[model samples]
Target: MSNQQPPRRFTPMSQFATDYPVLLIDSDAPLRELHNCVSERLNAALKYLHLMACTSLPDYAENDINTVTNIARILVQDVSDVFRVIEPRGFETLKSQ
Candidate 1:
């Protein structure tokens, strides 16, 4: 008598569509504009840092770093400007009152 083993059959589960929350942003809105502005500045800084780290060319890398640093300075100034607009100091305070 020969012993025969039965092959097991596998059944695959059906793929179900998953629902995900969608984030919608208005392109013409201030929130989207601010997001875009911040993204661009940060991307620029990251690219400059990447270039500086990857290349041994100090002349070019130094310039790139400097450019990023300048952009950072400008961003800082922008923050200060926004702060001023949001919370302007009184003239007396400015005059050391």
Candidate 2:
């Protein structure tokens, strides 16, 4: 049988699009790998957030602003990608197994 599945989806605020499209997490991947990916993306998102926090000044050049915006778009895309696999339901369902 074919193994393909439909894309998972997310909504972002009206201000951004990814610099490159972010692919959905592969649910069939090893759980350990998924945890690694979640950690990576969350760390990257945190980095972008920290950088954005520094961009609020009145004298920065346009490229600095664009750099933050572009990465923010990518961060949004990546976080959206990661959250798809974070098991929104509590682990009680797993304990039952």
Best by TM-score: 2
The TM-scores, one per candidate, come to 0.35, 0.55
lDDT per residue as tens, model 1, 1-97: 8788653222122222335423222222344454455566566657755765786765566777677667666655444433332232233346786
Local accuracy by lDDT, each model = 0.47, 0.62
lDDT of 2 by residue, 22-83 (tens): 44456556567767876786788788788768766577788878877787677666665555
Model 2 ranges off by over 4 Å: 1-24, 86-95
Q: What is the lDDT of residue 24 in candidate 1?
A: 25
TM-score of 2: 0.55
Q: Spell out the clash pairs found in candidate 2.
A: none
Top candidate by lDDT: 2
